[model samples]
Structure formats: C-alpha cells, structure tokens
Target: MITSIAQAVALFAATNIDDIVVLSLFFARGAKRPHITRTILLGQYLGFFGILTVAAITSYGAVTLLPAGAIPYFGLIPLALGIKAGWDTIRGIDEDEDGAGRSLALPTVAAVTFANGGDNIGVYVPVFVSNSPQVVAVYCGVFLVLVSAMVFLARFIATRPGIGEWLERSERYVFPLVLIVLGIVILAEGHAFGL
Candidate 1:
C-alpha cells in the first residue's frame, strides 16, 4: 500500500509539469514587486502544503469507513481540470490570463495556488487513503521540486528570445490534454486502490 502511494505521489507530481511551467512563467515575468512575489510564494506554500496536510489527515481518519467505490470519482477531477486546461489552451483563453497590471498580495498568490491546486486533491485522495507518511513526504518533495523547476524554467524561458510567446502559444494546444491524461490516471488509480 505504501509503495503504491509512493508511486502515485511520484506520478501525480510528475504530471504537474504543466503547472510548474505555468507558474514559472508567472515568476519569470519580472515579478513586478519582489516583496509581492515573496508574499505570493508564501501564500502558495501555505495554501498548497497546508491543504495537503489536511487531506492526509482526513483520509487517514475516514478511509476505513469510506466506500471504496467512490475512489475513482476523485481521479476524475484531475481529468476534468486537465481537460479544461487543454480546452483553455485550445480556445486561446489560457493565454488571456495576465497578472502584469495587478497588485500582488498574500491573498493573490494564495488564491492562485488554491485555484491551481484544486486538482491536487483528486490526485491525492488515494495517497491519503493509504496512510503513508512517505506518500505525504513524496507529495511535499514533488511540490517543492516542481516549484523550483517552475521558477527556473520560467526565468530561463523568459530570458530566451521568443520562448515566452512559444510557451503561451503551446499551452492552449496542449493543456487540455494534460487534464484528460491526469483524469484517466486517477480513475485507474482508484480502481487499483480498491483492490
């Protein structure tokens, strides 16, 4: 069970490449206000890690009593989000989001993290059910790694001539497919966990 959870965490984290990439772009945009950027990071950390902790505890408590059948539905969530992301990319809406004109604050970054991490819950439910601290650690580690990757990748791509436009243009075509794949993986995990 623990091993399974670990695998799931690893996969979940790896699947978040798009988000890491998206977030990197946000940071690469010169971070209008350094202090505001820091606040956003703080909020993002607290919101994402904090919620993950809660999910772990909640799963630990109720998993035994919960119907195993309800598991796959949780996986469906990332699928939906991924699909939406892909759709947004396809529809040109993903590129429409720009934080440039806005003032940054703890609430803003935290809010963005919360919105982005919605799919985390879906990917995490099975991990939570397994009651593995290692799984939690894996999640945290994965999150941290992704965050770091986003920061560097975005910064790098931004520095390169024309890469920023390239990324923005590609996500519309690619983002929704990520959601679909995540959804399928989660649903499969749900079935595996049940057995």
Candidate 2:
C-alpha cells in the first residue's frame, strides 16, 4: 500500500511537471473568459482519465500475456520517457508552446493535454501493469487529489504573475531532471535492466 502511494506520487509528479505551465497559461486566460479555469480543469481531468483508461487496457493485456517475472520489464516505459524528456531539454525543444496567446477553449485545452501527455501513457501502463486492481484504485484516488492540488497551485501561481514566470523559466531544467530521477527510481525499484 505504501509503495503504491509513493509510486503514484512519483508518477504524477514526473508526468505533470509540464502541466503546471499549461495550467498557468489557462488560468491567465481565465481573466478574459470567466469560465476558463473550470474549463481547463475539466478538460485536463477528462484528458488525463482518458489516457489512464488506455493505459489500464494495455496493462491488462500485457499482464495476461506475459509471465509474472517479466512484469518488471515494464519499467522501460518510464525510463524511455525520462530519457526522451531529458533529450528534449538538451535539444531546447519546448513542449509547452507560448500558451499566452492561445484562445481558451475546452476542446482545445483537452486536446492539448491529451496530446502532450503521450509520454504519460508509457509511464502509466508499466506502473499499472505491476499492480493489482485494488492498488490501481488507490493510485487513481491519489492521482485525483494530486491533480487537484496541482491545478490550485498553478492557478495561484498564474494569478501571482511573478511566481508563474519564475516557475516557467526554471521548470525547463527542473522538470527534465525530475523525469530522469523518477525513471531511475522506477527502474531500480522494479529491478529492471538486470539490476
């Protein structure tokens, strides 16, 4: 149980680092569209859960086909995502477009979230594959709470202006590092790579 909670936190933090910037942009736009914040949050939730459902389906299939001992191999998914994130950072690729100019719309925000989270599905499937239904339930609950907290934090930072800018600037370095460390943790814990 404790391990599941910790894994959930790690996965959420690793996967959602870029979301802070996106959410901040959404909140900033909320000034013009009064419903922007709610729309962004709702869209994010819908997109995130949609991705999770896909991961769950993949996990179910993988578990049924693979042997129990091969479960840990799923850690490669996050490891690869982490490496890609780090590489993107090194290559100066910006995942979050200057959301400052984007028009606030529910479908657009949801589509952006869903597309941006392609990497998340990789990480989520492996984690879900290693867990039971009950553990996955706990992860879902924890993820819900954390995502809410993230939205609030992003909204607060957006309203602040200064903090939001600072976060956006620093997040480039910090977020990729978080992904790398998370990948290492997942690999280590799963005893992948013959460790």
Best model number under TM-score: 2
- How much lDDT does each candidate structure score? 0.54, 0.67
- Per-residue accuracy of model 2 over 122-144 as CA lDDT, tens digit each: 68878887878999899989988
Which regions of candidate 1 fall more than 4 Å away from where they truly are? 1-9, 28-32, 35-37, 62-102, 164-195
Best by lDDT: 2
lDDT tens readout by residue for model 1, 1-195: 466546655665654555665454444333344554566456657656654665565577744333445545554554665665556545645332363522334653454455455356556666657646775676557666555555455466654657656544454444455446645765665574553
Q: State how far residue 115 of model 2 sits from its true place (Å).
A: 0.7
